[model samples]
Target: MDYRYKVVDLFSGAGGLSLGFLQTKKYDIKVAFENSPYMQETYKKNHTGVEVQGDVCAADYADIVRRYGKIDVVIGGPPCQGFSNANRQKNHAISQNNKLVKQYLRAILELQPKAFVMENVSMLKSEVHRFYMEKGDEEIVKRCNIPVKDTFLHLLDGAFLFDGAIDIVKDENLINQYLWPEADYFELNVIYKSAKNISKMINALDHHKKKLESLIETYTNLKGDDHIAEEARKAFSAIKAYYDGTLPADEIKSKIEPSVMIQRMLSKAQEIFQNNIIVDEYVQGSDLAAKIRSFAVYDYLKDILTAPENNYVIYSDVLCAADYGAPQKRMRFVVIGIKRDISEKIALPKGSYDADEYRTVKDAIGDLEDIKPVYTLAEDKQGIVLPKAENLSELASTLRDSPVLHNHIVTKTTDTALERFRALKPGQNFHCLDDSLKTNTYTDAKRTQNTIYQRLKYDEPSGTVVNVRKSMWIHPEHDRAISIREAARLQTFPDSFVFYGSKDKQYQQVGNAVPPIMAKAIAKKLAKILSKKRNADAKKNCTKGNGRQSHKRNSQHKHVAYPQH
Candidate 1:
């Protein structure tokens, strides 16, 4: 069989991966998947003849296969905000956003591509969120009464469970009757609010005999509105007495089983103190591990993605873009799968350069130093063309792939802001400002990192160049923020690969892309491996065909003497 090595890019942002793979001149990128209108237009503009689609979930793979035959490889970077370290509040709902990863998996399963490469934020590989998750789960569970058997409850007229005790049993219809939400026994409330029904209370369920006896004694001395506590005491005592007496096994089993209250604090050797609990112990008490483990889809895919049988291998690791020669320091979790039946174990190329020899901000934008930029005229919101360059480094030359640059236009600023920029040195940030110049952007004026209004350091590698329109990343030498063209340069987008959108949208597209240069190196290496496999497969087919021909010739001449005859 012959091979063409076609590729499908999922979650394709701004065509960075496509550009890199094109640079390899190996596989043909037949289709790209990007939902953003601006990014879609930009990709279409740069890489013509490729089909672009929106919505990965709604993608019609059968149609794609007809247009472009069996896709050999699938590559892309899914949205990472759900697992990004920068997100302080991580939860089941937030992590649910990672369903995009599962969607990527769906493409692989449906297409059964020969190989796949995926990237996400690095924090996905870390367990740091466990501590916070466990804490949150424990608190939530406490507020929600966990049953001894984990069974949900049936309400008076509808479906409801764990409508536990009120945090405070309130005023009632009568003096003796305690008030609960909705009065009919199930509160018209949310999950968090449902826990107020007292049944979930830890004190209510813990050491029933002793807690009730103590409470009973206290209740004897209590005055007005002590009826709720009295009723709790009587219930606990009755349950304890019922357990004390022997009942038939079936009878006991049929009846409600006793469940102790859930405890937030834990115990160690001969010690019991909530105040003494440590971080490690606190985290262990949570179901956070279970929740997080549940959010992950790889384990579920293992059964579906059988190795040796499926002819491919799927695995992942947290990779640094810096390792791939990206000018900025970026860490992303990369998931790679190689179809062994099509090729050998796919080893991603080792980085050519290390930190000490990292590509710097200067290497990325050195040639544009002399060029001054003007603000947009609102009609041409896309920046002015950068002047022709001179004395470009090898890295710069690659980044400036085309002679014409599209986003060289600068944003306009006031005199005061320019004056503040004059005070900021290359490595120094807003902190370097004098007391008079230091505005109270922060209440304490000391609560943030130096990066808030920091300028790029010329010699050092740049920080992650995010959407600068919002963050307003200052230029190293210039008074204003770095221009869109400059930001793209830092991102290793070739000069010719112009972005098609409003200035803000263009900046976002540039910021979101994988460094094309780094992506190119990866593409180049993977292409080599695939190319090697294709050649080997072709050679095997040739030998097999020759063998068949030889056999046919031998069969025709049944014996050697027959030919002579």
Candidate 2:
């Protein structure tokens, strides 16, 4: 009646996902499983009450089930090697046969919680290689048997339904043989022939279809193998059909026409796809809107159709840390699953600040009086230390040859260079480097003024913080690279969230982590949903009897122990 749920986090690296869900207030993370000792230690340090287990694969899921009767949600990201685009490029077979992905799937099947949220890089949607390899002479022969226009429509329709929904018919032969049989084709031909304008669109569609077919053939012959040829052939043919007006007229009129609504949808879709941080690779399609909508809708159906009444709701624009008041730009994919039997509309949390009132780097860490730069030789030595004044004997003596010291030789600035350094502000890049002092690195041979590194300004947001040391993230004014704390602050990591490992490891963790603010935002939404469900359950039970009312009050009391704020 109190509407509280327990969560089990798998692959809980630094408890980012766990933090997000806990922030939601509706669920309490009872136990979390992380394989890395470093990560586990960090998780334990930050989360005092929750149990942190090691090695999810080694840990007994059955034992967990026994300990925590029924887990309301199982949330975490599996190591997405198999579905990654990089893996696919290296070895398609190996990538496709990724054991970890299958293991993750097995875990989900075994756990059978009310619902689960699986997040991964977008490369999982890469065009299946088998689809491309089969686009050869055999496909051409198949197209010749069916009217090209009908074939195009069938393919698009199939893609829309299959990739866009969970209820896709798995048997390819059944789909090919029964769904779009020859009779259906003749029916479509008759309809096309009867309508004049529709016939014109059909003709245009046919022309593009033929052209695509030819291209597929050419590509296939050049490769001298049928592998992936069919897929390539089909994918191109589908695109041609959509663009050339061969797709169903009704669908086009309703959704694809260049109307204001369609335009806005397209624009939004483009923005979503473009800004998607997880998947940065090639996508072959004219309309990104169609693809994103298809995927989102498909995921919704997959999660919702057979789910319990209150188990799931579709959420979007779930901001990562940078989107809220955090100075760092960490974005992530968020999908929440709530039990439907509970009556509640799970609303997302309001942002901590308005867009104009966002927090900056200075606001996050400027008050930390000890602002000395330190590096690390060993993984364990990484941490924030206090800085000392320039002329102090103790300060100069402490600057030894450990990896934890900032060792940039202070530049003796000429009048011109000094003026340039003074003039440059935070967030400004090497472009502000004085013309006279510029030199080019080998990597920037073709570019002008390439060998310039600048210090960060206090007021502005830091550039993308990456693990690679010789890239864009140099200090704006200082000759040295930005300190670990500086990088963490930029990423909106709270001063309290300590990172473990050496300097390099710290950088990697900071760079790789989901911004805390982003995690907090997602958590807020989850909390609101849980609260609503709890109140609704309380009301429902009150009608049943006074006994149930007592249970509801007890649950509410338990919830108060873990304050939402």
Candidate 3:
């Protein structure tokens, strides 16, 4: 049975997503749209025989439609820098990168694909960082209602009342117990409930205060009737004191009008579906009138996806790479859209491993040939000898078996920085540095991320791997940052797939790649649905008793995996 379906990958960085679909032998990858000359070379070289389009932005849709008719799938993660939280610049909204998402959307609309897959830095779902979608962005902001203030803020506000008390009580540990950010406030049961109660109190108090303020605005404080002025003055003072915390909770109960609290929540709900961050997983967004404009996509799609209730759209929880036996804890967000004619719902395969069974950093990179971690700042490892591979774990074996290594090069680090790496324990980052070693002006040691300059724990899945050229990601057993091959291994790139370019470009290619193992699973699920539909059509044709044979399958559709150089 031929299950081949044609696909076009936009923003096809190094063809990682294409590689995933290729592995299933169920896809006929027709075109990959990438603009970078170096990345284009990598995709064309690794995904041999697939057509690599130079830049979709410049390509004419009419010509593309004429050249390749009936493109089954359009898939891409548009340039994420526009939506990325890491881009702290206020002008991120106007970055040319932000406009690239529309380019991706344009491809989908033009191709009219049966389905599409978009991979993005999970922040696309948030309102925190704002981006201009089009010319009339101001109108988008004007239409948004002031979101009832976040209750989680109220929880922290309420719980904060105890921070000083706990400090005085000499129980600093208690603060950690109650203030733990183990999950978003939306998911934390008590935190959300507490915030809900506080929200209602704030709303009621604000409403009354606004009313009294309006009356005072119309009638000068002296012009108001004496009793009326005295009553309004007392109400305002009582509400203000309640916020100041001097009036106490019981006193606020008397001072503020109590409204029905927790209207947003229902009784005995099994699941509290919340707009948690873009999971896969991570990130959130913010602001009042301006912030709500970012949810234009969410509000527009949400009603259509949910109101039909025909199971046409399925909202799956975030997919964690560790759960799928990947050697890293990389998380990602995914959404699937099926054309009405194909299937009603998509079934995600259950995760193959639990947290305890997650593949580890050791499981991924342990058997690689080792190189001495010491290197001068200008050292280029063109002839560095590598140690023999030993102690191969079963998982590591699947990633590589060849004795010859490629891209086994590390960045140059200073002797002083090496000493700092030595000081950090496994999984402890710059935050754990001693005062003498810490940057002089860096007062907030706690603000340091645990993964920065931290050694990977041997038995745990590594966190998201980024370009470590200037980063402080230390090798688990060594003082230096991980080599390119090691980073690729952690990203699950097979040994045969060698990246071509300068070391910087190679690292960028690896850092930007989607984990192949994770992508394959998604491809397999989509393949099953497409295959079933094709089979059903064939059977129906047979039942019609046509004397003619079914359309012959194309011989060229048979694909060969990429050949080694």
Which candidate wins on TM-score? 1
- lDDT of the candidates, in the order given: 0.60, 0.47, 0.59
Worst 10 residues of 1 by lDDT: 261-270
lDDT of 2 by residue, 1-565 (tens): 4466777887777775676566556677888887777778778886789988886667677787798777767777665443222231111222322334434545555666665565544343232211111123234324323211110101112222223211112223322322222332232233233233554545544554545444444433433233123333343344445656686643433322122121122222232333331222223243221221111222322343334432444443344454566664444444445555543334445566665655555554454324445444342244433444344322122222122322211223455445555655666545766554443222232353333444555565444455524343445445455565556556555445566654555666556555555665665656555566667778877778887888999999989977865
Tens digits of lDDT, candidate 3, 438-480: 6532325456566667777787888888886655778888777
Error of 3 at 484 (Å): 1.0
lDDT ranking, best first: 1, 3, 2
Query: Over the stretch 510-556, how does candidate 1's per-residue lDDT look in tens digits?
Result: 88888777778777777777778778888999999999999988987
lDDT of 1: 0.60
Q: Give the Cα error of residue 163 in candidate 1, in Å.
A: 9.1
- lDDT score for residue 126 of model 3: 57
Candidates arranged by TM-score, highest first: 1, 3, 2
CA RMSD for every model? 15.9, 18.5, 17.2
Please identify which of the two predictions, 1 or 2, would achieve the higher lDDT against the true structure.
Answer: 1
The local distance difference test score of model 2 is 0.47
Q: Where does candidate 1 stray beyond 4 Å? A: 1-4, 83-92, 128-311, 377-388, 431-450, 554-565
Candidate 2: Cα lDDT at 382: 45
Q: Which of candidates 2 and 3 reaches a greater TM-score?
A: 3
